[model samples]
Target: MANRIRASFRKSARSPRAGDGKHRKDVLDSLQELRNSIEKLDDTVQRFTFYNLQMAALRVGIDLSLFSSLVESEKPLAVGRMLRYLASFGAIKETEKDTFTSTNISSTFALLGFQAAICHYANTALQRAFNTTQPAFFWLQTQPEKLALFQEYLTTNCAGMSTFLDAYPVREHPTALHPERVFFVDAIAFRNRYRDLAGRVVVQDLAPTLQHAIQHAGVEMMEQDFFQLQGIKGAKFCYFRNIFHDWPDNKARIILQNTIEAMAEDSIILVDDMVLLNAGVHWQAAQLDILTMTMLAARERTQEQWDQLLQSAELKATSIQTYTASLEDSVIEAAPV
Candidate 1:
């Protein structure tokens, strides 16, 4: 009888009751759901903090530029002296040594081509433009001041981009096996499109202007659509940076197909763009993707999406390499097979 009781006990221990099993599963499911919620909350807090810091830094930079150009000129001036100097320039009404009114600072900055200040005053304008409002494009096109300020901002900030491109070790890659020919193609044709308004803006004679520039750089000037590349039969390799993501999958496929057609059996195509990892998407890339969506109906892509697009274009992704620049933006080097 004791042996029979022992056997029954063992069996009961091995097999849980139905109610107990349901309760255990419920506990585990609750725990997992709680963990996922906590993780999402953490991500939200991190993103908010990052944006806050970026905005604060931008504000400081703009205020410094506006109040006293000398603050950024040769040396850092005392805040008191800077405020006094701004008052002399009629930028501020009555500047206190320790603190000045935000309104005064903002007004001065707006007049001085500070992007942060312009962004603050033109909040509605920016939101409209950046959020895909119908009137936004009109504002950007018709408002000369807005366009001027935007260009000034680009001129100041674009140096970092230029430096990154300059320092990129293009020569390290084996030139014998894969010679590189940099081709810059944009819708804007004439250099006058970039000149200041008061400058001598001549529109006539754009072809020679482009030819001269390319000849100076020892590059061929081809007015071919990137989506339909031709005469690239003999090229060893081709590279397109920040181009593919500007279009949707179908359009990007067309560009990729053209690139693939241009490649020889052993040739490579390097695409420099974002490779959004599964771990965490970078904030800058995400925000830029939003802006692109608003303006051009384009977006950023992940590695898997890129693979799918390449395969759809009848091309293969051989490898992908990621690198972080000094700035927040990361660069992805993808090769085509």
Candidate 2:
């Protein structure tokens, strides 16, 4: 089994067609399980010790702003023991003796959201887990700095994740869309993708969010509250990405209903979110589920839950297109009943 796993890893690294993404994930998970089963008790205990120390090192490196420094330097930076430690763990690559370069993991650690997540998890979530009565949104509102960081985190996360456009064929829509009639709600991260689409893209978000958004050429920015009536009427596509998952069903329905009222007969609601399986949920999706629950008292939906939620909002999914396999990232083409 160990030999087979090693061969599979080598093949996957070298050959494009060695395995599909889903197969690769399965193999990795199996290898992990196998390692756990065969490891000695002392090694398992030592592994926990190593992980704890790694996390401490990671946090310390973030405090030093080392990751971003490495990423921005472009050329390899000469470094010493601490950097060598990080390189050994694959957080960075050792280009030469006593010199290190940033890896994707290190680059990611440099992102504001990624750094903010460490702060949030340690200072906010863990500290307040037992006693805090307020949900993450409400709590964040009181801490202006943390709120800004959280918003940046959301933007970075949305931008980095698989987009709905990759899965749904917008050009293939049956109804011809009018120019300047596409409404994207709470979407500031998809500026580039929206730029090339047939219609005009009006990005709607809260005033605070609009202030931070990088102005994209030809994209209209508008302040919006999804709980209130949608301002952009008769839009060809009323799109919401990574929005509905932040709220519970009742709250989600309110947002959907507001948009539904503004939809024309030909209009569609494009919802980009995870559509989890009833069983065998992916670890990433499961992690997000817990995150939403911790932050907002919300959960990622199953297909049945999505169907039910849309139906309650007087709409139905015309088609569900899955773009990412393991995470089940999807675009739900929805229309009013």
- Give the best candidate by lDDT: 2
Q: Estimate each model's TM-score.
A: 0.43, 0.60
Residue-wise C-alpha lDDT for candidate 1, range 24-44, written one tens digit per residue: 575557556654655543344
Candidate 1 off by > 4 Å: 1-158, 161-174, 177-215, 325-337
Candidate 1 has an lDDT of: 0.47
| lDDT of candidate 2 over 283-311, digit per residue (tens) | 44554665566457677888988999999
lDDT against the true structure, each candidate: 0.47, 0.73
Q: How much is the lDDT of residue 22 in candidate 2?
A: 78
User: Considering only N, C-alpha and C atoms within 3 Å, which residue pairs clash in candidate 1?
Assistant: none
